[model samples]
Target chain A: MEYLLHIAILVSIYAMLGLSLDLIVGYAGLLSITHAAFYGIGAYGTALLMINQGFGFFTAMLLGMVISGVVALVIGAVLSRFRGDYYALGSFGFNVIIFSILLNWQSLTRGPLGIPGIHRPELFGISFSDNVMFLILCIILGAIVYGVCWYLTRSSFGRVLTAIREDENMVQVFGYATPYFKLVVFVIAAMLAALAGALLASYITFIDPSSFSLNESIFILAIIILGGLASHEGALAGAFFLIVLPEALRFLGFPSDVAAQMRQVTYGAILVLFMLYRPQGFLGKFRMN
Target chain B: MDILVQILLNAVIAGAIYTLIALGFTLMYSTAKFFDLGYGALIAVGGYATYWSYKQIDLPVWLAIGIGVATAGLLAFLVERFIYRKLRERKASGTILLIASLGVLTIIQAVIAIIFSSQFQTLSKNIGSTRTFNIAGGVITDVQALIFISGLVIMTGVGIVLSRTLFGKAVRAVADDSTVASIVGINSPRILGIVAAVGGAIGGLSGIAVGFDTGIEPLMGMSLLLKGVIAAIIGGIGSIYGAVLGAFLLALIENLGAWQFAGEWKDAIAFAVLIAFLLFRPKGILSK
Candidate 1:
């Protein structure tokens, strides 16, 4: 039961990531590989605040969102100038830069040693210290993220985003500032990814640079890809499936040493197979042109 | 003065490797119109193939290197034929191709890790006894000299071929406009396949150079590929000359930045240069 709870919590955390990434990559038509950079920003920001400044979880998380939003605005402005492969490459550069900061800025992030003993969120007479309580908090936060995404995708803004995805020139001809739209969606997605990072930091009670590398960004991307791009529910389902996959592999009785590599191979195969076979994914409405 | 010379020499050596990588990368991008991240994987495949033949199978060093480069070229040719060709036939978006390449990268890196156990091993066994030469108070190893010579030779050879040969003209046509090239009787698909093979071979050579200079590991390609990509961007994405120029400039800046700050910040410096180029000069220094 406890094991199941742990996995559920992980799924919820990653689901937030999947949903957030879906907004930019799916709805906004921007293929970003820098989600983990924002995720790392949130994790590090929140961790430092809690560990050093003695700020509560909520305060740190909100501040983390603001910081990520500001950074995203800058990065998004630059990335908006690029299209297709350049956009992805530019975003990838950001992820690597941020990761380098996390790994090298020893005075701030403690470098590779990582921050430990992070306290879970505590509310009005409600401590989320217990696993079950934490699970509830994760679900509630996950649902709110889902709801926000749902509203955005269904709104006029979302329609514009989708239109921009399909044909940015046409959307611009229709008199919408496509760059602003792209920038705004990119910022929102970064903030949500930060939220997930904050939740993860508080829940795991530890955070490190290794957890937020380019590989993590790719993993987040794999989640949305597997879940089906542009679909919030697909993100959720994808997160659930991926988070549980390692455990499923564990049960298969493979050598522990090779299990991780096998998982990577599976992810790689998924990306290739999906692109070749099901570009729209299971529940995605959008397909790459 | 001596320290400065050594740093300059180091930058040049590093530039040699980046030149190879960036050259191959730009070549493929010119033809394929997408970032084939799988090209990064071919680096490791080359190094490991050489390692397996030289160490495991006890082949001669030259034979091993040949096998390594050939293996990478074959694998790249196959990938182009089996995977990228299908996508191109369907007119898949560059974004989709990029994601698929990411998948290819992940799969190759993992497979290498699973097979090689992610250990850092050197290609050259005679590390201590290897011959070295001093130029202007800076030292150069035999392998490093070879890397530099190979880069220059390959660059000149590729330039000549592209400018002088019929096949190169076909490649240039395909790069300029595959649709028009196809209409003009140029087999764009075959040209792309050849480009992939050639690019993969160059990338393999760089990996082998690195393996000899430092060591080999599965994850080594990512950082190297990033630097190559940055160099390619700096020089002008589709221009071979620009790729070479960019590689040397990038290496110099990286070494200088490392000298100014710390060695670990080398990757950050390269990326900062990339972001700057993307913003100020997205088309790069030389665009043909």
Candidate 2:
């Protein structure tokens, strides 16, 4: 039961990440691979505030979101100038830069030693120290993000994002500043990613640079691709499936050494197979070109 | 003055390795028009093949090198034939290809790790046995000199192949416009296959050289690939000579920058240079 609950908590956190990324990659048609950087920013932000400043989880989370947003604003502005593959490359560079800072900024980040003993959230006299309580908090936050994403995608602004994704020039020709739209969605996605990061930090009670590397970003990307691009249900389903699939594989009884490597191989095979045959994904509204 | 010479020599050796990788990378990018992340895996494939043959099977060094290069080339050909070709036929976009390449890279790296136990392996029989030569004020080991010589030889060979041969003409025609080239009966797919094979061979050779220099690790491919990509992009993507130039320039900058700071800063400096180039001159130094 406890193990199941732990998986549930992780699924909720990843669901948030998948949903946030869906906004940028699915709706806005921008492939920003630096989503993990924002997630890390939030995780580190919340961890640092709680440990150093003695702040509550809610406050630290909010602050983390703001910090991620500010950084996204700067990066998004520069990145919005690029289109298609260049956009992916630019974001890829940003992720590397952020990761390097996280690893190298030893004075502040404590480097590879990682920030340990991160405190659990205490909100409105309710301590979320228990696993069950933390799981509830994560679900609530995930739902909130999902709701925001659902509403945003259905709005007129959401139409413009899809328009930009399909044809940026057409959107610009119709009098919308496409870059501004891209920047707005990018910032929103960063904040939501940060929220998920905050939850992860609190739950794990530890954070490290390894968790936010380029591979992590690619793993999150795999989640969205496997789930379905541009579909909210797809994001949820993808997160649940990817998270649960690995756990299910664990029960297959392969040697421990080979199992982990096999899991990665499976993931790679699935990604390649999907991209080749089912570019539209299981529940996706749009097909990745 | 001695330190300066040492740094310069180190920079040149680094530049040679980068040139080989970047040349292959640029060749593929020009033809395929996508970032082939799978190329990273081929680097590891080359090194591991050499190690398996030389260490495990006890093959001669030359035979091991030939087997390693052949393995990489054949794997690249198979990938292009089976995976990338099918995708290209479907008119898959660059982004899709990139993602597919990432998947291929992941699969290959994982397979390598599973087989090799993720432990760093050395190809050199004895590091201390290598003879060191003093060129001007800088010292270079035999392996480093071999790498430098190979880099120059491969660059000249590729340059001649691309410029003076009918095959090169076909490759250039395909790169300029695959559709038009195919319409004119150049057989673009065939040219692309040959390019992938050639690129993979060079990439494999680079992997072996790097293994001899430091060691081979499953995860080292990504960093090496990134440096090569950076060189290709900075020198101008799709331009062979430009990539070679960029490789040397990048090597010089990274080495000089590392001289002033901690060694860990080397990668950061390389990336910073890449970002700067991307921001200021996206076309790179020599625009094709």
Candidate 3:
């Protein structure tokens, strides 16, 4: 039961990641792979603030969102200048840069040593210290993230983002400032990613730079790609599938040494197969062009 | 003066490695018109293949190198014939191809790790017995000097072929416009397959050299790929000469930055240069 609860928490955290990345990649048509950096920023921001400033969980989360948003604004500005393949490359570069900072800035982050004993959230004197309680908190937060994405996709702003994805020049010709729309969605997505990061930091009770490297970013990307682009339900399904599939493999009695590589092989094969046969993904309305 | 010469020498050595990588990368990119991230994995393929042949099978070094390079080239050719050719037939976009290539990279790297157990391995029989050459108060190992000479030779050979040979012209035609090249009776797909094989061979050579110089690890391809990509972009993506120039410039900047700051800052500095180039000069230094 405890193991099940741990998996649930992880699923929820990754579900949030998939939903947020979908907004940028699926809706906005920007193949941005920098989600993990924002996720890291949120984790590091909340962790540092809570541990050093004695801020409450909610307060730290809010500040982390702000920090992520500001950083996203700067990054989005630069990323806006690029389209398609360069956009992906530029975003990839940012992910590496942020990861380098996280790994090297040993003073604040403790670098490889990582930050430990992160506090769980407290609301109105109710502590989410236990696994079940933390699961509840995660579900609630995950639902909020899902709700936000749903609302955005239904709005006119969301339509513009979709339009930009389909045809940015056509949308611009229709009097929409495409760059601003892209920037706005990118920022929003970064903040949402940050929220997931905060929850992860609190839930894991430890945070490290290694957790947010380019590989993590790629994993988040694979989640969305597997789920279905531009489909919120797809993101959730993807999160569940990717997170659970590896765990299921663990029960197959493979040697521990080859288990991790086997998991990677599975993911790599899936990505290739999907691109070849099912680029639209399981639930995605938008096919990755 | 000695320190300066040492830094310069280090830059040249690094430049040689980056040049080989960029050359292969640019050659493929010019034809495929997508970042074949799987090309990066071929580096490790070469290194590990060579290691297996030399250490495990106890083959001669020359034979091992031949097998290593051939394996990478043959693998790349097969990948083109089987996967990328199909994707191109479907008219998949560059982004899709890039992601598909990423998948290939992941699979290849993971497979290598699983087979090799992810432990760092050295190709050289006697690691400490390497002869060192002192040039202008700077030291370079025999392998590093070989790396430089090989890079130069490959660069010259490739430059001559592209400029002087009919096959090179066909590749240039395909790069400029694949439809037109096909219409003009050139076999674009065949050209692309050959290019992939040649590029993979060059990448394999660099990997084997790196294995000899430092060591071989499964994950070593990624950073090298990034540096090569940066070099290609900095020099002008499709221009062969530009890749050489960009590689040297990148190596110089990286070494100088490492000299001024901590060695750990090398990647950051290299990436900073990449970002700067991407922002200010997207077409690169050579493109008009």
- TM-score per prediction, in order, is 0.95, 0.95, 0.96
Say which prediction, candidate 2 or candidate 3, comes out ahead on TM-score. Answer: 3
RMSD of each predicted structure? 1.9, 2.0, 1.8
Candidate 3: Cα lDDT at B287: 91
Model 2 over residues B214-275: C-alpha lDDT tens digits? 99988677778888999999999999999999999999999999899866678778878887
TM-score leaderboard ranking: 3, 1, 2
lDDT of every model, 2 decimals: 0.91, 0.91, 0.92
DockQ of each: 0.73, 0.59, 0.65
- Among all windows of 10 consecutive residues in model 2 chain B, the one with the lowest summed lDDT is B262-271
- The DockQ score of candidate 2 comes to 0.59
Off by over 4 Å in 2: none
Query: Could you tell me the lDDT of residue B43 within candidate 3?
Result: 94
Q: What digit string (tens of lDDT, one per residue) describes model 2 on residues A1-289?
A: 9999999999999999999999999998887778899999999999999999999889999999999999999888889988988788778767777887898889899998999999999978999999999999998898899999999999999999999989989888899998899999999999999999999999999999978976677778888898899999999998999888987667988778678777778778877988899987789888766
Native contacts retained by model 1, as a fraction?
0.77
Clashing pairs in model 3?
none
TM-score of chain B of each: 0.99, 0.99, 0.99
lDDT of 3 at A234: 94
Alpha carbon lDDT of residue B272, candidate 2? 80
TM-score of chain A of 1: 0.97
